[model samples]
Target: MERDALLQVANFSTLFACMVLKFPQILVLMRARSTAGVSLNSLVLELAGFIVFVSYQMYYDYPPPTYLEYPILIAQDVILLLLILHYNGNMKQSIFYAAVFIGGWKLLTVEKRVIDLAMSLCTFISASSKLAQLQCLWATKDSSRVSALSWGLATYTCLARIYTTVVMTGDVQVLVRFVAMTILNFWVTATAMYYKPSAKKKD
Candidate 1:
């Protein structure tokens, strides 16, 4: 019983750390008042992944394994998604797309196996989009426009995920996902460093 309690505590701690890292992104976005350099595609895909994850948790009646992680993730994604859509002047389309996608998932009442598969696919898509966005930033040499605080938070979150995966072995697929995310996080950090953005040019 003691061992199980300790394990649970450790797991919760790690998950909390990951969520904490991501929480600041919301503040950063609000302060910047611009999602200019952030990738809308990445945010969209990430929102998809989070929706799938939350659905799976609800379907399984699983005590949300990560405590506050999912809630904060969903909140941040929603805010960021809205900001991106508003900035891009696609608010209506974005709202429609989100409603359709989430509604479809709910209507399907997908099985656990199917949910797992779909969630994995969404994770990959989201990660790929983030990588592409980072590549775009590098290509454009406009890292300055990106939020440094958000990037730092992402790096920390990825590291926390890695640690959590290493500590838990119940799900091989999840471990693999975290490994991929960690690698991608490192690449993003490197790009951010190498392509540090300059100050905004005078109007």
Candidate 2:
């Protein structure tokens, strides 16, 4: 019982940390009032991945923590996505994206196998989106809009969660996914470093 309690605490702590992780990113965007180094598509894809994972957990009737993580993650990303759109004068575009996201969410909620496949595919797609974001950062060599601290913390949190996951479930696929996400997070961090100075000069 004691060991289980400890594990539960660890699990919740990790999830909660991840849930609140985007706050720093949000702050970065709000303060700068710019989406210069950020990618709206990347946020959209991440939101999709979060939705699919949450749906998968719901389909299985997984633990509350699993289901709860969805809304928490969604709440953060929605704000980020909206902020990105608003700053980029793409708020009208968000309406269409939201419609499509809602429709996709509805479609995915219907079946178990579909949810499973989506979770898998969304994970890969989200990783790819992040990679694309990384490429953008490198090409522009300007990560002024990127929150290095937030990405660094997120990367560390994923690494910690990956350790906890391996210790708790020993699930190969989940481990692989976590590993993949961590690498992307690291890439995000590196992008920030690649463009260290705060004030980016226009060429």
Candidate 3:
């Protein structure tokens, strides 16, 4: 197959992986009902990053079919956040968090170049999410609360995107974000594997 065809395959295949992969974290959170080792800061930063990323995609008029994934990502993460709050018995605080995220996303509108700025900010913040998780692991040396499946799939998907960017688009502008994200995801995955929680913590 041509490079373009292969790139398309890699692109959609990575999308499919992301679409199916995110729920594992939520599921793990639900079963555990505790955010002990889980980094709420990481989730908040990730949601912020997703908001900007989605806005940037919209600015470029990303294809409707594939672009739908961004909103889906936002929705699922919102649900996950709500679930975490509920389990922590902070229902009122949950509402506040929701309000903040919703208001922030609504206020993201500006000029075209502003969208580019947001996208760059989003990429940096998204990578920071991984750093937050890494710190949590480093401080506690417990990967118990982290979801391996979720991080694993995310790392794999991001790597696939980097490959597609290199072989297909050859667009440095597009490749930069994915490359950065892949590095962070790989780091998180490595830490997750290196630190093993006790049996009770794993619950």
Candidate 4:
């Protein structure tokens, strides 16, 4: 009973965190009316990784609770992506991105090997997404419109999933992904906080 309770807590905590994972970034962008310090490449790559991971989970018929947060995360990412593109005056490119994502989704599960391959590379893909954001911060040295809160929340979700995945799934792919994501998310949070304009101004 205790184990089950912990699993429930972890799953629900991850879900709740993911539900608002991108909201801070989205709000920051909208309020600032700019995509400054935000990385479009990072958002696109992150969205792609989310799609692949969720598709793999669904393809394998894993427990819903283990990955229920992904759809919410995906939806939030889509909204965030659109906002970035709109602010950057690249709204027209959204159609192309949407089409590619949809097509890739269909193809990923067409065969077991395909999904497995994607899962194998998922950690790197997801890590690249974080690295892309880090590169952005490095280039600008300003996290004006980047939300450290969102990245911190992401770190929490990934850590929660590290617990839940071990408890519920025992799937190595899922476990590795969560582990890698936990580290990267924390790194992003730290980097964003470091580059935050307010922090710089106070210095």
Model 3 TM-score, 2 decimals: 0.86
Candidate 1 lDDT over 1-203, as tens digits, reads 77567657656765666556555555666676666557777666666766775675566565555334766777767777787677677888876877877786775355667777776685686587677778677667766545555556555665565555455434555556656766776677666666664543455
Per residue, candidate 4 scores C-alpha lDDT tens digits across 1-203 of 99989888888888888888889888899999998788889998899999999999899898999889999999999999899889889999999999999999999999999999999998999999999999999999999899999999999988988888888778888898889998998998999988876787563
In terms of lDDT, model 2 sits at 0.77
Candidate 3, residues 110-156: lDDT per residue as tens digits? 67767777776777899888899888878878777678778888887
Q: What TM-score quantifies how close candidate 1 is to the native fold?
A: 0.76
Query: What TM-score does each of the candidates earn?
Result: 0.76, 0.86, 0.86, 0.97
Report clashes for each candidate as comma-separated counts: 2, 0, 0, 0
Measured over all alpha carbons after superposition, the RMSD of each candidate to the real structure, in angstroms, is 4.1, 2.9, 3.3, 1.1
Model 4: pairs clashing at backbone N, Cα or C within 3 Å: none
* Residue-level lDDT tens digits of model 2 in 1-203: 88677667767776777777889889989999998878777787788877876776677665665345568878889989989989988789888988988998999977777777787796697697788778778777778778788788778766765766666656465677778989999988877876867554457
Question: Per-model C-alpha lDDT, please?
Answer: 0.64, 0.77, 0.76, 0.90
Worst 10 residues of 3 by lDDT: 194-203
CA lDDT, candidate 1, residue 16: 65
lDDT measured at residue 139 in model 2 versus the true structure, 0 to 100: 73
Q: Rank by TM-score, highest first.
A: 4, 2, 3, 1
Scored by lDDT, the top model is 4
